[model samples]
Target chain A: MDAARFRIRRAAGGIDADAKIINRATLSFVLALLGFGFWKSGFDPTVVWRGLLVIVREPDILINDYVALAGLGPAFVNAGLLALAAWGLLRVTGVLISGPALAAIFTVAGFSLFGKNPFNVWPIVVGVMIFTWVERRPFKDNIIVALFGTALAPIVSEFAFGIGIASPWNLLAGVVAGLAAGFFLTPVARGALDFTRGYNLYNIGFAAGFVGTVTMSALRAFNVPLSGGFAWAENGPDEILPFLALYFASMIVIGLVEDEDALPNLLDLLRTSGRLVSDYPRSFGIGATLLNMGLMGFTGSLLALAAGCDWNGPVVGGIFTLVGFSAFGKHPLNALPPMLGVMAAASLTPYGLEAPGSQLALLFSATLAPIAGAYGPVAGFIAGLLHLTLVHNVGHLHGGLDLYNNGFSGGMVAGIMVPMLDWIRERRRHEP
Target chain B: MNLDATQLMRCGDELAKYLYLRGSRRVRISYDFGEERSFCAISAPDYLLDEAERTRILKVFSGPIQPEIASYYGALAGRRRDGAEIELLGTMAELEDLMVTEGGGTQIVLSRREAEYFGKRKKR
Candidate 1:
């Protein structure tokens, strides 16, 4: 009995050690992003401050790249700071930084380059906090949801600055709206999962889309004039490409340094369908999880470059999101089919391969990688094709208020496909 | 290791559902409590699971406990048809036993301990 107890204790210790490594790696990435940002701005405090002001004041709707609006330095700084704050919140709440936590933090950082900002994301988080208080649950329980709930950060910015509202009233309205969105997000997101049945990895995105749609409808009814536009950074691939290569390569190196069996473990990981709650850090250890993340990041980058797409803000944001989710429900094998489907759609449709929207669709379509993982690659390709067709049109529903537009679209695609695929499989099984 | 009543019930529910899908018409679940540990044992007589299926079940049930993932997705436990929720169950409780009975039946025991439970509670 003592030997059995000791074995259990030793196993628990191993899990703890892996968790610590993941936490450290995530923190190191955050610091590197911060240092890179400062270096890019030549350590000019004035430039960073000015750029940050521009980022905060902008109506950060869909296609609004902070890199273009405020330059590369402030954009990176904003992302790094937001991610750091998110990581700090998890630590303070006594939440273990696991695979999902890593995904949420990296996602917060990634989207900050395009939509999320320090000023606008807090209201929604505070709202989630309020929710936990109401439910009498610990804040740590819903911290991941709070981080992902920032998908609606643009709602705050749009309400505060875009609707032509004047002064403090606009800011007040934005805060109230953000709080309301966050308050309902948890319950709605939980319910939303049933709609997709865990096929769509970004469950919060689907819920936020519903919230954003209703909010947009209300704004439209009030005769609010919402003008849509796009802001993409066209230059800087020379710098961005090398930086990404080094960052992703470092992840692989770290993985190899941490674990001797990372390669075999990663192969084992790729064999399983990346369904929700597929916590790779726990299943394959943090070492293999990190290796998968780096490989997925490189796959996304190579896909964009091969398609003749420029390395822009949204493009980088898309790749970053892919990297983050790699530890959760994505890998190169499962993700590639959907991405290829998006690339094929771009080639066939009027949306050219180099188009910003098409490039993003290619990367974000990995949200449906579980489809390919569960079904076959052919089904995944179909999902990706459908995602491209629908994602372009759904933004008008939310009026670009949701940053995870691909998630919203992926939910619809999954909802449509899963039932039919199940029926087909059932019929085939019975035919024998 | 000491799960609340609700969590323990969920563990039983997930096991029952998993067994039901695998052709077990009746599942017997019993609980045991002690000062140091608590356990739930789910048993089915003359179970028909093959070696491959048994291996897969054991692998998933023996996976590490991930409380964070459980907190976010626990609501879906026992509601999924693809056995994914069983994965979530593995994240909440430890597998204690997967043994064959004299009648060629299967009994699986899941356990939680007071020490680890209080340790986590203190960390929280």
Candidate 2:
């Protein structure tokens, strides 16, 4: 019956309250993929299933393992799920969720376990929802803003738990701040676009910079403690790799079920800018998009593996994100140079070419795929080199306040590099 | 105003349909600037455009607004054009200019600068 309901290309707006049906199907299929990975990792299917069941029922009991698994698996799952949530929000509201919105959701979600969570994120969502009501436009219309708008999720969460405020005061101030953040987000996003121009993709990073700046100020004015974070991971490739396989496999399958012709559409996807409003589902159908996604995922995953980077939580999240953006703008044609440049730079420097930090630099820096897409391969290589350097060091500028370090770094890289690149090109043109 | 002839006529017809939908029957338009600036304007009675009807007309101008435009509208809604003296409000100049260009059943008048300046703003 569930299969009957969501017959791939046969239905529109699927994933309804027929939750059990899809849930069962998704769960079974997901677990099957999981089982294959665990088997490959030498775990019996029965044992893996029992462990996962316990993991699901009591997340805190397996909090250590679950968080470890979540840190890696959830990046993709969160981004994919965030996308589905956007899709659902769009389907229900008739608004087209913007690319920036999708990226924002993924970015914030990737940071959630440590910094953001369902509790903190809700206020931001609620705030944005209120703005939609007042504007007389369906919430979906501002999809990009709504999604990218979640950078403030940390503010919400920090307000909820970080401060020494009373529980009631904490929740109240936290939620109110989020709503105010949401209310002002649309206009602020619109207002800030000009300050940097289109060179920066993470306009929300720019928005978040302002937000975090103001938030830090407000927190400072009052007596509130908002500072510091810890790196939490128990580096284990054996456990993490299987989880990565399951998540990517599920995405590939979902994409496959939807694409009618997997082959040609994969080719066509490369031709697109992968910018906002890129509806690969509509343009290429399910099968092709899936194929492309799978290939991209594999390629990105392999890059992480070959780089010998640890397959812990954050790195996996970064890899999943790079692969997902293949549809948006991170095509192999464009993405390779930055990864190559970064690797080249790492190999020569004190940085270990095969290190997690190095891989993280290369992976997240792929967000500047447009440099490759916009300029020639040379510029992209340069952009990647520039990104690799800046991304590693830029976190401190925001005081790790802006969680989309790639975006924050991407903005700076694109902002500084593109103009200089253009000047150089112009000089070359003017020369004999 | 500098649009190709067919594009101009097509724009005119859309204005006519919009005016017709809003219950107007006759209209005229004039341009004060050069051929670059010379164009038509559509005039219709106020609120003669019901909500849906008004929206249909508004969609044409929303076009591919870059973030700059989106932000400009966000911040400058009620402020005049950047270099002009009119000190118009919000996106009023844009809304008015769009009406003038859709020249089938209405008349619109723009100052010399506005006549030449309607579509000048790009992404940056």
Candidate 3:
């Protein structure tokens, strides 16, 4: 009995030690990548500081591309800092290092390059925390959604910074709007999950789109002018693409070192339908999930390259978000069909293959990968086609307040297509 | 069988009540004599039971008395919900749509003999 107890203790100790090492390595990797971006952009503290100040002060409405508005250095710093703060929050909360958390953190980093900024995103988080208190649940349960739900952060910025409202009143109104958005976002997001029934992995994005639309409509009713049109940067793929490739490749190597089981579990990861609540870390382990994320990032960049698109802020943002989501529900096998479908749709339409809209369609179209997983590749392809077509029109409803416009489109597509697919299958089953 | 139809009805009532507590509204419990199994299908269109909850319930299902029905139905003489008389031993099969049950909730089919064994032993 003594020997058995000793062996058990040793085993537990080894497991704990391994977990610590892995966590340390993963955190280091993120910081190092961000540091590289900072250095590569030729770090000047004063310029970066100025850029960050501009980011916070900007109205940050939809398509208000950060790369175009601010320089690359500041945007990188914003993303890195925003992501680091989130990482620190996780550490403070004692949340386990898991796939969903990783996805959320990286998404913050990615979107910061385009839309999210530290000043704009915090109020929503605070609102989510208030929701936890009201619901009498732990904050951990909602942290991931809170991070993802920042797609609507622009609404807060618009109210505070956009309309040229007077100083103190503008600040007050913005705070109120952000708090209200945060408070209501929890229930809306939870309830909206049933609409797509987990087929659309970007569930919060779907919910936030509706929220944004209503908010924008109310603002417009009060005679607040809504801003619309495409915002993009036409430079810097040459500098950014090489960095992204090396970063992802390094992630794969690190993942292999952490777990020999990564490659084998990757097969299992691909087999999963990637429905909601499919937390990969709890099942496949972190190493394999990270490997999948790296592969996804590489593929997204490759797709961008194939389309002759420059790696601008939004493009990189879209690619990084897609990569992060791979840990949740966007594997290569499932994600590829929709990407192809977007490319196909672009060729058929008047839109140039490398047009910003088309590039966005390609990158964000992966949100429908679950449609492929649930139905078939053909269904996924159709969903992608429908997404690009719908996305162009749906932005008007929200007035670009919804940052995850693709999520809104994906949810709509899934809601319509999944039921039809189920009906067809059910009918066929009876017929045979 | 010492367990009469009334007792069986009571057992079914217990299951229905339990499933309702688990957020399933419309439940249908049926017994298959030929296959010696009992099926409980709940009309839970949006029923999502996390893994931890699933594991807890599965443990109860495989135990001496299914906890939800144990107090009233499992205390009978020489009877247990663990299916001693029935070969299935009170196990739940994988969740699926077995024969187009209402509301798309999970269907758990167990041996009827086990359910009977849950109330009373067969008397010769």
Backbone atom clashes (below 3 Å) for every candidate: 3, 19, 3
Native interface contact recovery, model 1: 0.24
Identify the superior model by TM-score, candidate 1 or candidate 2: 1
Which pairs clash inside model 1? B1-B112, B1-B113, B1-B117
lDDT of 3 by residue, A1-432 (tens): 011111111112233444464477557646764685578457778777888898888767667677777777778878888888878877776666555666777788878887899888888888887886665445755677678878888878887888877888987887788888888887788667667776787777889899998998898899987444356788857878877888789778876777777777777778766655344554455667768888998899988988888677788888878877876778998899888999898888877576677788799998889888767899889988888888778888888877888888889988899888888877887894
Q: Where is the poorest 10-residue window by lDDT in model 3 chain A?
A: A1-10
Question: In CAPRI terms, where does candidate 2 land?
Answer: incorrect
DockQ of each: 0.24, 0.05, 0.03
Best by the DockQ measure? 1
Per-model TM-score on C-alpha atoms: 0.90, 0.63, 0.76
Name every residue pair that clashes in candidate 3: B36-B112, B37-B111, B37-B112
Ranking by lDDT: 1, 3, 2
lDDT assessment of candidate 1: 0.82
What overall lDDT, based on C-alpha atoms, would model 3 receive against the true structure?
A: 0.68
lDDT of 2 by residue, A68-147 (tens): 44433332233334444544554465432222323433454344333444455566777777876565434544555666
Per-model i-RMS in Å? 8.6, 15.1, 17.7
Going through the candidates in order, state the TM-score of chain A alone for each one: 0.96, 0.74, 0.93
Give the TM-score, chain B only, in order for the candidates.
Answer: 0.76, 0.40, 0.45
Highest-lDDT candidate = 1
